[model samples]
Target: MIVENSKVILSVKNLTAEVEGVQILKGVNLEVKAGEVHAIMGPNGSGKSTFSKVLAGHPDYAVTGGEVIFKGQNLLELPPEERSRAGVFLAFQYPLEIPGVTNSDFLRLAYNTLQKQKGLAELDLLDFDDYVQDKLKVVEMNPSFLSRSVNEGFSGGEKKRNEILQMAILEPKLAILDETDSGLDIDALRIVSNGVNQLSTAENCTVLITHYQRLLDYIVPDFIHVMESGKIVLTGGKELALELESRGYDWITEEVKV
Candidate 1:
């Protein structure tokens, strides 16, 4: 399927993938539009991360069935870098450490690469430094972070802040944050959420893939979807998250099994 200019940015219908033929997602379906935030919640091993990886074109997870359409094109047909250049960004749950590369350099590479993908000119050293400084302010990161290696020796909070820094700079059309709220203190959570809020608008969409509702308290989503086994069994507004927080997944599992 091909689209020239579509309003729906992402469409995942019956998306199924596997690791070494071990099925993960089963008939999963989701859609995201610009200017909205959608949250995916599930128990352990529920394929939440698999869904993110598949969307991002991770080589290890084989797409055994289903389709993913992003920005009017079949996403699986593109390479991971290509997908990212097309305005799809996935914030990793565990960011890696680059020993030799300073955070500033890595951010510049990512920013310039994204701009190049848009057929825009790359930022010079001066422009790049200014750009990153603005983004750091968005995440409330310390000014000294620029001198450090990419996440080397960063505390849990610092690592998460650095992730947010990337999100703010990229300004992706679709941002999939994988467990972004984990390992953050209250102040850090607020700072990260505040950054996301400042960046989010009606023209950009965000997907918060998380297990706890605590994060939702800060970055309230427009939709909350609960995944179990492999499929999404419940879809509701933010209230559903509060309900789940009080009653647990047992309620939904019992209802579905009955």
Candidate 2:
């Protein structure tokens, strides 16, 4: 269980954002402490995915107002690459395919880039091969995956597993998995959720952006929040997820208005 006294790792205050002149996030405020797992759930168009992208410094989204502070530094001030190097990882819902780049090469490049940024020793090909092999076990992946092009011909589950594999190798402080449960089968979901649960620690945090409560069963969150109209309308504990799953989100939205 996460303690309340843990230091805040992420602070968002009245964060408003837009994409292509359309406002998506309206004054979103959230605080994430070390060791905490936060689940953001809502219906379609509630801006759950947008919040994840904005945190990662996506180029298309414009920050119209407010600020984000991560690890005592201005997060919005950092570029996307800097954000990743600074230990902020965003796992996209639809993992992209890089047909030309080998998976091992891609992971090694990313890991080495972060290592260099932190003044740590860079791993050579031989060293990285040994290192990544251990991480592949986190997702039950085979060595053959390392030789294949990045997500080139991978199935949906394979792609998600590859994303988690990257997260394991990078070891980010705050990992935001945006709808990772999407398009996954029971077996795939279990593998992905187990990987996530194993990776979460007292020193790191995870933010899960999802619509279904089923994912929460495997990787339970310390806090569950409901998003509506681009804002976090309600926050609660794990039981809230069960409530949302049973009764739907209308009751919460209606209560908020009253």
Candidate 3:
């Protein structure tokens, strides 16, 4: 539940973006307040992923028009790294594999970097190990995975767990998870969703971009949005997911057109 007078963490106003000269997000507008969880659902090619990418400041997508404000600042002016530092995190749909970097090292570096930016003391390797170990419990990750290369040869479930581990450590103010439930079996999905629920608090916001209602079953959203073509045409409470799941997007699309 959102607190009384909870501040808005993110606001997108008439946000339009494109990739390689082709428009993907067209006049997207959203208001996410602290303590809210929002789910954006749509059919294929409806620009759900593109919206997340654009919010993360992906270089390939150019903002043609509109504004994105985060924490009272112009989000569009910040580069990706700066946005990360400012507590905006985007969990990729497909977590990348880095063959040379150990998961522990990569996580520590990222955690320490954010600490340094905040003018806080950085933890030594030993200290970071203990800190990250505690975070691993959020996702039920094993300690052995820490020594292995980052997501190298990790199964789909492991990769997704590692992503949650990253989130647990960094503790961003806003987390945008793009298709995070993809390619996971039931058990993995439950584990990941539980971690996300543990991480959510009254001070942070979460935006989940997905294509199915199963994900919402685990990580319930305060609001559900339907995107058609390149825009969100409908917004409803969690019950809307059930409606969409039963009747499909055709009815929503047709309703919007009418």
What are the root-mean-square deviations of the candidates from the true structure over C-alphas?
3.2, 0.9, 0.8
Q: Order of candidates by TM-score, top first?
A: 3, 2, 1
- TM per model? 0.95, 0.98, 0.98
Clashing pairs in 2: none
What tens digits encode model 2's per-residue C-alpha lDDT throughout 61-130?
9999999999999999899999999999999999999999999999999999999988999999999999
In the range 24-102, model 1's lDDT, one tens digit per residue, is: 8888999887777899998888889989989999999999889899878999999999988888889989989888999
| Model 3 deviation from the true structure expressed as Cα RMSD, one decimal place | 0.8
For model 2 the local lDDT of residue 216 reads 98
lDDT of each: 0.88, 0.95, 0.94
What residue runs in model 3 are displaced by over 4 Å at the alpha carbon? none
Candidate 3 C-alpha lDDT tens digits along 111-221: 999999999999999999889878989999999999999999999999999998999999999999999999999999999999999999999999999999999999999
